[model samples]
Target chain A: MKPTNVRAKSLVPVARGGLLDRRSFILSGLAFSSSLAVSNAVASDKISTSKIDQSLPPWMKTPGNGDTEYGLPSKYENHIKRDVAEHTPETSIFSIWHTPIENQRGIITPNGLHFSVNHNGVPDIDPQKHKLMIHGLVDKPLTFDVESLLRYPMVSAINFLECAGNTAPNAVSLTPLDQTAQELFGQVSGAEWSGIPLKHILQEAGLKPTAKWVIVEGADGGSHARSIPISKLLDDAIIALYQNGERLRPSQGYPMRLFVPGWEGNANVKWLHRLEVTDKPAFTKDESGLYSDILDDGKIQRFSFHMDVKSVITRPSGKQVLPEKKGFYEISGLAWSGYGKIKQVEVSADGGKTWAIAHLDQPVLSKSLTRFYIPWQWNGNSTMLLSRATDEFGRVQPTRAHWRDKYASYSFNHYNAIQAWHISSDGVVENSYA
Target chain B: MPSRFLYPRCLKFMLSCLLLVTALGQVAAYADDATYTTDLGVALSPSEVSPYEITIFPSGKNLPEGKGSVKQGEGLYQNHCMMCHGEEGDEGPAARLKGSDGWFSFSDPLRVLRIDKYPILLISVGSLWPYATSIFDYIRRAMPHYAPKSLSNDEVYALTAYILYLNDLLAKESVLNEETILDISMPGKQRSVSAWPEIEL
Candidate 1:
């Protein structure tokens, strides 16, 4: 039989029946296992931190290996990696690898760990062989090789790409897994993308007045396609050539991908090879049916492109245990809005009864991640921690009760409700809706 | 359908226009360089773009010449599909693709229901998709699960017809072509609404 629970005794005990007594009954053997490690660290404070090393550290004594053509992260950082999930383990082509946001710090996610949602897996594309085609309702069809696109004047912006289907498990009525913030909300990632404006090429092709939408198709095996309004194309859209200052990663659409700032990630088509101008939205399978949100009302919300304002605390989240029963800990998390810059993010340690203003990191860029934090003091009592973010346009992240009020019987996609992580008296944190 | 204006790149024409544009700054990254080089891309004839032009829209544009019926699709389904999608496409080890039992017939998850596992919505045609073109378009792009884009145009049309027939939208004797597929009015067609249509940007 499979057992989901295992108990661990708290080394430091608080008052009786506070929360430490209940932490032993929590889900997962991982928390029980980590409690032992936490106990060990407490027993050997100075020695655990390497102050009393038996010998000189191997890396300090020996010279490091020769340089590489391309650098990789240190072996110690191997544990920090994306959590992958497929439609099924049998079919490898369709999958998504969530970024390990809990193990990460700072605003920008590294290129390697950047969250990925590949419908046809990563395609092996040769830059030399790849060419971008612009046709359909244009005055004339045009084809530009990679070299030609590189020569065009380019623009760069730091933006976050959040999948429309991101963060529903914890945000909605879906069975919340004993998961980290990375597993739940890691579908959102920020990157510095550099590329030519899409309109630059469409202008060369000469958009006909009849052109109201642009159907961007990828070169992946599925030829995954989605339709975008022509107005957004002329606004801040780009055919991205580089990601985080390097030739685009193969998984991130090697030669090029369409980048629509402040919009849903699928609309920013990756592995882009063609842009067909049309009079209306293509009603593609992904957009019309898949990405579209099903509301509580009888109507299904299609073409809901703007990602709502959302935030989540990465540390002190599910599975991670606090080392102390009573102590001061800086609560930190990432926040972003597809609508505009985050105006403010408020934190409430005691559920929603009272609130404290969290500090927003300076120079908040629109559509990019904004890290928020506040000094939190634990009082050895079980309590619920919550956070809410407001954007420049004044759209605040709604509560779980508010979110469910609007969504349907089985609505799953576009879930960005305010997260509630319950902190036990023993310092174990878990996802809590009650 | 030929357009009116044909712009050719010239250094002299660009240099003169460049001076006038410098006086007025830009809002976003883009400024209309060409009165529309400002033509770096090579112009292509219709045939050159034809090889990659398999995309089909709601308007039934770009569908290749082919025809298929439910009978042909039945044989093809057993050979290529049936394993993951199952005998009726509803008894799935994969996605449920047969039935469209109106709305809200599936299980709701997590909280109030205490769903022991992650909820996977089993969406089928007529319930999920609004346009019939999307079914044919999706199958042409991705299908048979293991080997994608390996099916013939006739096979794609056949499968499209079969799936539609299974959903009770098409008759058992129905044959689908580019024109006939567009004529299908999916039950879920008008069910979709924009959550926030006022945000025009």
Candidate 2:
């Protein structure tokens, strides 16, 4: 049996009268024998709850007072915390620590707890001194300070930005026993972003006839520049200044950033400083030799930027061990597509052999995160779990091998394969490769 | 017959001359209406027309001259890139560049959902990118982040050659300079189609 202290630390007490609390209590009591000791050392050591307090203040402590300047998730009202794992100055890439998505309820990823992927170290950019310049192939090159950008009409959308290399480790044949959901898929989260339309700025600048591409450069030390096609700029691109309905976080391109809808997160250049319209693409390292993919056919694939449709069963995923019962369990997760809105998400308990349609929460916005749920009853047998998503455009999620044949596995930008989770008889769920 | 007919013809000619003068006056007035400014001198040459300008299209045009063998690139990759990008461009805790199952579907729903099907803005050497000029320009500007823009034109070309060779796009003996680099065709070029038409508001 697991230690009593370990179990106590791992489990958060449920409100006695609440519906979920009663369910959780009943479930906990029944599964107590099989429940392993919550490894506090592993959990606490890996995740620093201190970062959570940095984003929250004292006055908002009470539930009704709503201490969050930005709101905390309702279900996880008390689990608010920053997701920083370790900070290093060298590559500027900080760990989001590791938060199990299986434990999360509802869709709004908490601001402090949102996963972070920084290329160059995060810059302490002062909004007072920050400015966005629109130059290059334009009749008039104009610069907008943060104040001026705020004056323009603002729009908001609940969207998710995921690093292209979010799940590169899952490609490894060896299952990473030490891996957490945050490490496997923590690089993604959805937030309400508010910003000005990129097209509005381009129209104001009066794009010249020769302009073919706009090169967006970040102010970070890496300067992190990439050439975005002119068409995407005019579509739904925005110069987002606010995330989760407030000023952008420092780690997430504070002051200002480019929100390239439906494209790779990196292309949505964070800490945006300059938009140079040019007659040709700016061969920035991030776009050419770096972001470009070398395919299997002895040819390099360049500028292939749109992220495809994908879905993951957040609950019953990595790290979370389930109960050894034959009763119904609520399987829920988030699904999204860069192409368009996710029309439907189907969950398959027996791998891809059979699938059952899952329910999606309403207000399905385009290029936004959509929550999905299905009540699953386990029969006390080991099973291969999978979920497939179909976007509005009729694009279905492909198998791992199908994607590998097109673009060799060398490039890590678009790895939207059907993910699988293995359920042992003991109910310990693990990351599995089928 | 003479004098009376000649008098009428002279009157018609005189009226025609007056009309021609008025037209000329209007033309002169139009020219004088426009004013010229001397504050800004002659128009500057377009940046694209500069001598150092190098741009490559998908069809391999406008490539500069220079040659870099794979053997030469191997040395440069070893000395500079081996530590971070990996010895064979596959090593790195940061992001690996080799041995990916290119189009393999990930079993993870997050991974599957995030993979782009027709990724038109690829940042790799194999897909979506239309030009090789970017390869030279990018390597010349920011690469080996520890030592930014440290490689010479030849070394950049050599590194480009080595990377292309590793991807199996370039022959081992082939030399890559500004000139020949664009000549080598990338395989995933066909996959990168034109962008979708913008919806008119």
Candidate 3:
């Protein structure tokens, strides 16, 4: 059956103050956007209307479209752009831009606005000249040009790549109470990446048994390189040449990138130019001096690769106004775990005092974003809202205090504590550490 | 067993035959013939290894032949690095690279004690970095920020030596080369270990 525009007809009245009853409240405001109306409509199993409207809206009045080679999102979505955060404005090289997570729908982050962290700035690479050299512990050293690598067997996997330093930049000290969801957790993003399975190429080169690590280096000005465990590389790493479905954006490594399914974003080196099989890590400056974190007692933590389970409530979060006090609203959010699939997401309306399980949408693949929702009824009183995620391995999202008690002294990387949003009596939502 | 139309033995035989066929059908239905191999991409010659593989390990196995002194390095640092890393290499438009003794004493006293014990957390070339060879690898790959990989082999070694000298890990007269870089001991070298020894971060 052809799809109809359901959003146009889903409008309902705004419930306010003490005037609303349970029955009336269920039929108004946030209730219209809930699953009840849509599920009821589907169960009826009838066309939207017995008689259709013959007249069409402006653009639809004539021929629907003239065929084009490429497609673009609707003009209404112009506001969906990556927001920039300048760590060092003097040089554009060492800066980060976060994906507008709240503005995006579903698990797939678009190619244009995928979160990017650059150390030495994005390079303008010539695909024709780009070559991937593999040597060191391999039986036979090989250099595969971009064209040659493309011809090899390819695989597609939908995975999320997150920076180890994703949420640390927006630590409580740096962000104000009115910080938006994008500002806090926009560095992580998911995409359907397509490329050659690194193992396939490595097999051809005959990887030596002694080769325990693989050194991946980018072609950017920084020549960004990181040593990855060979087991991780052989298991699921891909030399990703495409993002979503098209060529990789220049900022995201362009001609080639090393895409490790569930590792920190930096480990998946962009603009990949070389891979050296080695018995030990290269101990590059990035891995040794910069990425490593030190504890309060001075012991060092190195190679903290896998991102942990984390969740954040996006809708009705910080900086968003409720529009009306006591109105019905559906609480929604995104959850992900680098280890595996998100098993469950719990929503708490009264802080940690109580929590209700939110509905996890279907197609919950491993290491990809999982969307969750629950119907929340507001009482016009000041209240706290939060979401806590649990992954397939039964790991629960910890509170900020609990997380700090354990990790604050040692490191600032991998901050995945449950975020709380406070809705004041005046209908303003603000970030709350509690 | 009590069927009137057929004998019990006959019925049992027929049921067994039916079950066998169903099991075989399932096996056949699930079988896939897709091939996982593809004969694509070309191999490389052994000669390509020396020219393209630029990585320098902690063991100093693959370091190129080059030498530089603090005197020469200071000039290179001023010409290529000073604008971003500051003249003394402590203040920065990027990360600070020197002055470990007084790092956080002004801001927090506890930090001072921590640095006194394990100064690697201060993030300079001498205190935190484990291997001196990594200095050359990093400078060759990512340094001089805007013009990366622009420095010659000798220049990279010179800058590596100068940064180490500023941290007081190296003497002014010491000339750094591939043979001497790996021997240079860093204060944080003994404690620094790669491959994530800690489970939780």
Best by lDDT: 1
> Which portions of model 1 show Cα errors greater than 4 Å?
A1-61, A86-93, A171-175, B1-37, B101-120, B195-201
For candidate 2, the TM-score of chain A alone relative to the native chain A:
0.79
lDDT of 2 by residue, B65-132 (tens): 56678899889888877775656554343333333323332443332222332121123344444455
Interface RMSD of each: 3.8, 11.3, 5.3
Each model: TM-score of chain B? Answer: 0.68, 0.55, 0.69
> What Cα-based lDDT does every candidate model obtain?
0.76, 0.64, 0.75
Mark the regions of model 2 whose C-alpha exceeds 4 Å error after superposition: A1-100, A171-178, A409-411, B1-201
Deviation in Å, model 3, residue A44 alpha carbon: 37
DockQ of 3: 0.29
Order of the predicted models by DockQ, top scorer first:
1, 3, 2
- Model 1: docking quality category: acceptable
Alpha-carbon runs more than 4 Å astray in model 3: A1-69, A170-177, A408-410, B1-35, B100-103, B107-126, B193-201
* Per-residue C-alpha lDDT of model 3 across residues A1-434, encoded as one tens digit per residue: 33222222233322221211222223234644565643343366566655456675776556686767877777798888887764434255487789988777788898888999888888899999988888888887777778766665577778888888776633324343467888778899989998887887788789888988888888888888898888888777888998998989999999999998878888999999888888888878777766776544455557878888999888888788888666767677899998899999988777667676777888798888898877665778988888899999998888887776654343556788888898899878888886
Q: What would the per-residue lDDT of candidate 2 be over residues A393-421, giving only the tens digit for each residue?
A: 99998887786677654555567788888
Whole-structure CA lDDT of model 2 = 0.64
Candidate 1 true-interface contact recovery: 0.58
Assess every candidate by TM-score.
0.83, 0.64, 0.81
